[model samples]
Target chain A: MLRELFNSENSVLYHVGKFVMWQKEIYKKPENWSMYYKEIVRQMYDIGIGSLTIVMIISLFIGAVTAVQFSYQLSGGLIPEYYIGYVVRDMTIIELAATITCLVLAGKVGSNMAAEIGGMRQKEHIDAMEVMGVNTSAYIIMPKIIAAIIVIPLLVSLSAIVGIMGGYLASIATGSVTEADYIKGLRSFFVPYNVLMMYVKAFVFAFILTSVSCYQGYFVKGGSIELGEASTRAVVYSDILILVADFIIALVLTS
Target chain B: MIRVEKIHKSFGEQEVLKGIDFTFETGKTNLIIGKSGAGKTVLLKLLVGLMKPTKGKVWYDKLDFVNLSKEELQSLRMDVGMLFQGNALFDSLTVEENIRFPLDMFSKKMSIDEKQERVNTCLAKVELEGVNHKYPSEISGGMQKRVGIARAIVLNPKYLFCDEPNSGLDPKTAITIDELISNITKEFNITTVINTHDMNSVMEIGENICLLHQGKLAWQGSKEAVLDSSNETLTDFIFASPFLKKLRNAAAG
Candidate 1:
C-alpha cells in the first residue's frame, strides 16, 4: 500500500516538475528563433492542418446528431422549434465545440508530439543537443508549445463555425426549424461572456496538451515500449485533465 | 586539462565507476580504453559532465565541476565539445545548419556571411564541401561521422570529448577518423579525450592511454609502450584476439 501510494505521489510530482520546466523553457531564447518558428509551422501543418478533415467530420456528425436528438425530444414542448438553433450554437460553442473537440484534438496533437519527441529522445537527438551545448528543452519543447498556442485558437474557431453550420443544415433540412427563426434564437442567447469563456478554455487546453505530451516525451526512459507508453499515457492523462480543468473553469467563470 | 578525481558512479545497486582518478593532458589524443562493461564510457560521461559522479569531483583546469552551479555548468559546456558514439546529427537539420548550430547559439554578433564562411571552413576541414545542402540521412556513415566531428570542433572548444568515435566504421575509415582526431588535436592544441574499446585506436593515435579494468585504472602509458608492456593483464588484453596480436607483431617488426 505504501509503495502504491508512493508511486502515485511520485507521478504527481513528476508532472508538476515537468510543467515548471516547460514554463521555464518558454522564455529562454534559442540560438535561432526563426528556425524554431519554421519547425513549429511545419508541425502545425502536420498536426493541425492534416487533422482538420477528421476534426471537421467528427464535429459535423456530432452537431447533426445533437440537433436531431434535441428536436425529437422537444417537438411537443412549449419551447419553439427555433430553440434548436440556440441549443446547437450555445451548447456546441460553450461546451462541445470548445471542450470535447479539444479533447479529441489533444489525442491527435498531444500524442504525436509525445511520440515524435520520444522517438527523438530514444534516438539520442536530445542527447546530441546536450553534447552540442544546445538546451534540449529550449530547442525542442519551445517550438511545440508555441505551435500549439498559435494553432489551437484557430482550430477551436474553425470547429465552432463548422459545428454550428452542421446543426443549422440538419435542422433546416428536417423541416423542424427555419433559418430565420434559428438565427433569431441564436442571437437571443448570445453572450460575450460565453465567448470569452470559450477562448479561455481553448488557451488552457492548448497548454495542457502541449506541456503534458512534451513532458512525457522529454522524460521517456528505456526504449520503444517506453516511448509508446509515454505517448499513450500522455493522451489519456491530458484528456482527463482537460475535462477536470474545464469543469473548474466553468464553475469559476459561470459564477 | 581535464581531471577526474576519485570519481564514483552507481546505478541503484550496481557501481559503474569505483574511483576513477586521472588527468587528460593538453595537445594529445588521451584515450580511455577497456573491455566492454569496464566503465570506460561511464568515466567519459563523468568527465564531460553528461552524468554527475556519485562520490567525487571532475575538474576543468582548476574549476571543480561538482561545485559549479547550472549557469556555471552551461558556461563550461560552451567551451567544451563532444562527439557522441552514434554520430547523433539532428535529422531535421541540413549539414550546413548542423555545422552552424554552435555558432548560432554562442555568437550572436556574427554576420550570416561570417557564419556561412565558418560553416564552409569546418566542412572543408572534414573534406565535406558541397554537401552542405544534404540532410544527415542523405550522407554516408563515414561522412555523417565527419559531420559530427565538424560540428564538435566548430566552436574551437578548449576541451574535446569523443565517445567511441570509430565503433561503426570500417578499418580504413576508422583509421581516417583516428588520424583526423590526432591532426585536430595537434593543430588546435586542445585537450582531447576519447573513449574506445578498439585496439586499433589504442595503437594508432593514442598519445596517452588510460586502461580501465572493472572500473579501476589498470595502466597509463604511451602507444609505443603499449606493445612492450609486461603487465600480464594488459598483455592478455592486447593479445586476446589474433588480429590485435598480429598488429602488435607488425608494429614490433
Candidate 2:
C-alpha cells in the first residue's frame, strides 16, 4: 500500500512537471507565422461552430430549470415576484453561464482534443512532423489553446444571452411571473462586474481545459485502449480542474 | 554520415539498447536488420532524435546530436526526412497539401506557384502525379507509400530514414519501393538508413548492412557478403524460415 501510494504521488508530480515544461516548449517561436495563423483559424471554426448547438441546448434547459425552481421556492414569500428574474440573471452571469458552460465544454472539447492528438501520436504523425523539423508540440497544440482562449469566452457569452432568454420564456410561458415583472427584475440590481467575472472565469477555464487535454494527448502511448483512457482522463481532469478553479476564482474575485 | 558511438538506451529498469556503435555511410543504402524486440525501432528513434540515448553520443558529421540545444536540433532536423511504416500522411490534407507541408512551413519566401511546382516535381518523381487533390483515404496503400516518399523528399533532405518502407505491400510493390529508395539515394547522394526485417530488402539494396541480435550488432557486411558470410547469428536469422533455408541449401549445393 505504501509503495503504491508513493508511486502514485511520484507519478502525479512527474506529470505536473512535464505539463509545465511542455507549456514552455509550446510557446516557443513558431516555425512559420502563416502556418500557425491558418491552423488557429481552423481550430477557431471547429471549436466555435462545432459546439454551438449543444451549448445552446444545455444552457437553455439549465436556465429554464433554475427559473422554475426559483419560482417554486419564492412562492407566497415576502420576496418580490420579480426577484426570481434577478436571481437567475446574477446566477447565470456570475456562476452558471461561465462555469456550467465551460464544464460541459471541458467534456466535449477536451475529449476531442485528446482523441485527435492521441490518434496522431499513435499513427506516428507526430514523429513524421518532428523529423520534418516542425515542433510537434507547438504545431499541434498551440493553435488549439489560442483558439479556445479566443472562442470559448465567446461561446460562454452566447450561452449567457440564450440562457437569460430561456429564463424569460420559461417564466412568462408558465405564468409564474408576468413578462413585465421578469423584465423589471432583470433590469434591477444588475452589476457590470458580474459580466467581467464571467469573462474571467471563461478565459481561465478555457486555458485549463485545452492545455490539460493537449498534454494528455501529446504524451499518449500504447494502442486504442490507452488512447481511449487518455481521452477520458482529459475530460475528467479538465472538468475537475475547472470546478476547482471556479471555486478559487469565485473566492478570490468575488470577495 | 551518421555515426552512433557507444549508444545506450534504457526504459526504467529495462535496458533496450546496449552500447551500440556503428557508422552509416553516405551515398549508400544502410540497413538495420533485426528480429522484432531486437531494438530496431528504438535505435531508429535515437538516430532521429525522437528519443535520447541513456549514454554515449550520436554524431551527424561531427555535430554531436546528443549535446545540441533545442534550436540546434531543430535546425539539424531541417535536413532530415523520415518515412514511417504507416506512411503517416495527414488524413485531412490532400496529397498535394501533404507534399507541400514542409515547403509551406519552412520556406516562407517561396511563392505559392513555386511551391506548387516543387510539389508537382516531387509527385512526378514518385510517379504519383495527378493524384494530388485526393485525400489519403481515397488512395490505395501503395499510392499512399508513394505519397509518403514524395512528402519526405519534398524538402530535398540530406539524410533519409525509412522505417519498414515495404511493410504491408505486395512483393512486386515492395521491390519497386526498394528500387525507388535506392534510386533516390544514388540520385541525391544522400545517406539513407532503412530499418527493416525483410530479407528481400537486404538482398536488394543493403549496401551497408548492420544486423542486430538482442541489441548488439550481430553482423555487418554488404548484401553480397550477407549470402556468403559465416556469422552464426546472421546465418541463423537469414535461414530462420524453412523456405529460405531450403533455398540457401539449394544455392549452396
Candidate 3:
C-alpha cells in the first residue's frame, strides 16, 4: 500500500487532488486588505486594459466576416437580406462574442498568468513569500482570479458591441442591406434572455481560464523547460475547458 | 532555539534524509554543511516547514512545529525569514518596496512613514542606503543579495534561514555577505541556520556546524573543531581539493 501510494504521487489524480486542496488556501481571508487591493488593481490593468487591442482586432473581424457570410447566404433566398443584421447581432451576443473572445483570451491572459507565476516559482519568489509568512496562494493568485472574473465579462460585453458595430459597417460598405432595413432587423428580435446567457458563459469561462492557468503556474517544478511546458498546458487546458464549459452551459441554458 | 529529532525524508522510492537529531543555537551562525545530494537542502526545507519530513519532530522552543494547526503554522511563519539562493527579490519592486513588503503586509498598524523609516533602517543596516528606488533587475547580484537580507530582517524575525547565500558571488563578496549575516544574527540574537558548502563560510562565521554524510549526521562541532577533527567524512569533505589537503597536511605538520 505504501509503495502504491508513493508510485501514485506523480499521477494526474495526485495533481488534481492537490489542486482541489490548494483552493482552500487561495480563498482564505487576505492578511491585509490594502495590499490585496493594490494587487487586484494592478492585475485589473494588466488583464483589462492590456488586452483591449487584441480583443478589438479579433472581435472586429469576427463581426465583419459573420455579417458578410450571412449576407451572402440570405441573398436570392426566401430570407430577406436584412436578416443578416439580425443574425449577426444575435450570433455576436449569444455565441461568437463570448466563446471566440474567451478562446482568444485563454491564450493571451492565460499564458501570461502562467508565465508570470511560473517565473516567480522558478526564481523562488514564491518561496521567499512563504518564508515571510505571506499566504503565497492568496497573495499571488486571488487578485488575478478576481481581476479576470470582473474584467473578462466586461471585455466580452465590449466585444459584443464592437462586433455589432463591425457588422453594421460591413453591411453598409457592401450594400448588403439598407441602413434603415439593417437597423430594423437589429430591432426586430431582441431577446433579453440572450444577454443573460452571454454573461453566464463569460463569467464561467473567465473563472476557468484564470484558475486553470494560475494552477498550472503555481505548482510548476524544475526549471525553464518545466515552466514552459506548464505555460503551454495552461493555454491548452483552458481552451479545452472553455469549450467544454461552453457546450455544457449552452445545453443547460438554451434548454 | 530550533531543534529536530529523528528527522526522516524520502522522495518516492529514494530516502534522502535518515533519522537524525540536532539543535540549532540561537544568536549564532549554525551551518548545515554537506556535499550536494547529502540532504542539506531537504533538512533546511523540513525545518522551515516547506516540506514535511517522513518522520520527525521539529521544535521551536517548546512548540511542536510538525504538528501545528494552520493558524499556529502561520503564526510561527511570521517569526521566520529566509534568504533564498537567488535572492528572490521581486523584479518589479524597488529595493525600498521590497524591504517594505513584509512590513506592509503584516504590520498593518505601522503607517506609511513608519514603514519607509523601517525600510531605510534595514537598508542602512545592510550598508545599502542610496539605491532604494532602483528595481531589483537594475541592481548587481551582490546588491540584490543585500536587498534580500534587508527584506528578510525587516520584520525582525526570531529565526533567519539562508540557502547557499554565497553561491554566485566573487570570493570577496561571498565573505562580505557571510559577515553581514553573522553580524545580523549576533546583533538581533536570532537563530540563524545556513545551508552551504562554501568552505570560506564554513570557516569564517561557522560558530556551530552540522555535517551530513549519506543522509546521517557525520559530525557536529565548532569551526575550531573542524580542522582538528579526525572524522574521515569531515576530512574528505573539507579537504576534497588537493590544495586544501596539502594545506591541512602542512598545518598538521
Candidate 4:
C-alpha cells in the first residue's frame, strides 16, 4: 500500500513538473513576430466569432432561470419584487457569466484544441515544424493562449449584458415585476469591483482552459484512440481547472 | 558531415540503439536500412535532435548537437530540413502556402516576390509546377510526396533527412523520388540521410549504407558492394522473401 501510494504521488509530481516545463517552452521568444501575429489573428476569429451564439444562448437562459426562481422564492414575502433583477445581475456578473460560459467553452473550444494539436502530433506535422527550426510549442500554443485570453473575457462581458437583458425580458413578460422596478434593481447597489472580478475570473479561466488543452494536445502520442482520449481529457481537465481557478480567484480577488 | 559517436538510446528498460557510431559524408546519399524494430527511426530522430540519445554525442560539422543550448539548437535546425514518411503537409494550407511556410517563418529579409520565386523554383525542381493552389487532399499521393520534398528543400538546407521517402508510392515513383533526392544531394552537395527499409532504395541511391539489426550496426558498405558482399545479416535481410531470394539466385547465376 505504501509503495503504491508513493508510485502514484511520483506520477503526479512527474506530470506537474512536465506541465510547468512545457509552459516555459511555450513562452519563449518567437522566431518571427509577423508569423505569430497572423496565427493570433486566426485564433481570435476561431475563438471569438465561432463561439458567440452558444455563449448568448447559455447566458440568456441562465439569467432567465435565476430571475424566475428568485421571483418564486420571494412570492408573498416582504422583500421587494425588484430584488429578482438584483439577484440575477449579481449572480450573472460575479459568477455565472464567466464561470458557466467558460465551462461550456471548455467543452467546445478546449476539446477542439486538443484534437487539432493531437492530430498534428499524430500526423507528424509537429515533427516537420520542429525540423524546420520552428518553435512548435510557441508557434502552435502561445497564439492560442493569447487569443483566448483576449476574446474569452469579451465573451463573458457580452454574456453579462445578454443575461441582464434576459432577466429583464423574463420579469416583464411574466408580469412578476414592473419594468421600472427591474431597471431600478439593476441600477441599485451596483459594485464596479464585481465587474473587475468578473473580468479577472474570465481571464484566469481562459488561461486555464487554453493552456491545459494545448498541453494535452501538444504531448499526445499513439493513434486515433489516444487522440480521442486526449480530446476528452482536455475538456475534463480544463473544466476541473476552471472550477478550481474560479474558487481561488473568488477567494483572492473578492477578498 | 554529420557524425554520431557511441550513440545509445533507451526507453525505460528497453534499449533501442546500442552504441551506434557512423559518419554521413557530405554530398552523398547515406541510408540507414533496418528491419522493423531495428531503431532506424529512433536514430533518425536523434540525429535531428527531435529525441535526445540516452548516451551519445551527435556532431554537425564540429558543433556538438547534443549539447547545444536551446537557442543554438534552433539556429542549427534552421539549416536542416526533413521529409516525414506521411509527408506531414499542413492539410489546411494550399500547396503554395505549404511550400512557402519555412520562408515565411524564417526568411524575414526576403520580399514576397523573392519568396514566391523561391517557392516556384522548388516546385519546378520537384516537377510540381501547376498545382500551387490545390490542397493536399486534392493532390495525388505522389504529388504530395513531391510537395513534401519541395517544402523540405525550399530553404536550400545544409542537411536533409528523409524518413521512408518512398514508402507509399509505386515502384516507378519510388525510383523517381530516390533519383530526385540523389540529384538534389549532388546538385547542392548537402549531407543527406535517409531512413528506409526498402531494398530497392539501398541498391539505387545508397552511396553509404549502414544496416541496423536489433539495435546495433550490422553492416556498413556501398551499393556497389551490396550485391557482392557475403555479410550474412545483409543477405538475410535482402533475401528475406523467398521470391527475392530466388530472383537473387537467378541473377547470381
Task: State each model's CA lDDT, in order.
Answer: 0.85, 0.93, 0.93, 0.94
Q: Which window of 10 residues has the lowest lDDT sum in candidate 1 chain A?
A: A2-11
Looking at candidate 2 chain B, the ten consecutive residues that score lowest on lDDT are B70-79
Q: Please give, for residues A133-204, the per-residue lDDT of candidate 4 as tens digits.
A: 888999999999999999999999999999999999989889899999999999888999999999999999
Tens digits of per-residue lDDT for model 2, B1-253: 9999998999899888999899999999999999999999999999998899999899999899999997788788888989999999999999999999999999999999999999999998888878989999999899999999999998899999999999999999999999999999999999999999998999999999999999888889899998789999999988899999998889889
Residue B191's lDDT within candidate 2 is 93
lDDT of 4 by residue, B102-142 (tens): 99999999999999999999999998889999999999989
Per-residue lDDT over B180-228 for candidate 3, one digit per residue giving the tens place of the 0 to 100 score: 9999999999999999999999999999999999999999999999988
Which DockQ-derived CAPRI band holds candidate 3?
high
Q: Where in model 4 is the C-alpha error above 4 Å?
A: A1-10
lDDT of 2 by residue, A170-240 (tens): 99889999999999999999999999999999999999999999998989989999999999999999999
Scored by lDDT, the top model is 4
Give the lDDT of residue A194 in candidate 3. Answer: 98
Task: Report the C-alpha displacement of residue A74, candidate 2, in angstroms.
Answer: 1.4
Instruction: Estimate candidate 2's alpha-carbon lDDT, on a 0 to 1 scale.
Output: 0.93
Per-residue lDDT of candidate 1, residues B1-253 (tens digit): 9888898999889998888789899999999988899999888877776788899888899999888987888888877888888887888889989888888877878899999998998888888899999999998889998999999998888998898999889999999999888988999999999999888898899889999998888999999999779987788777889987888789989
Which TM-score value belongs to model 2? 0.97
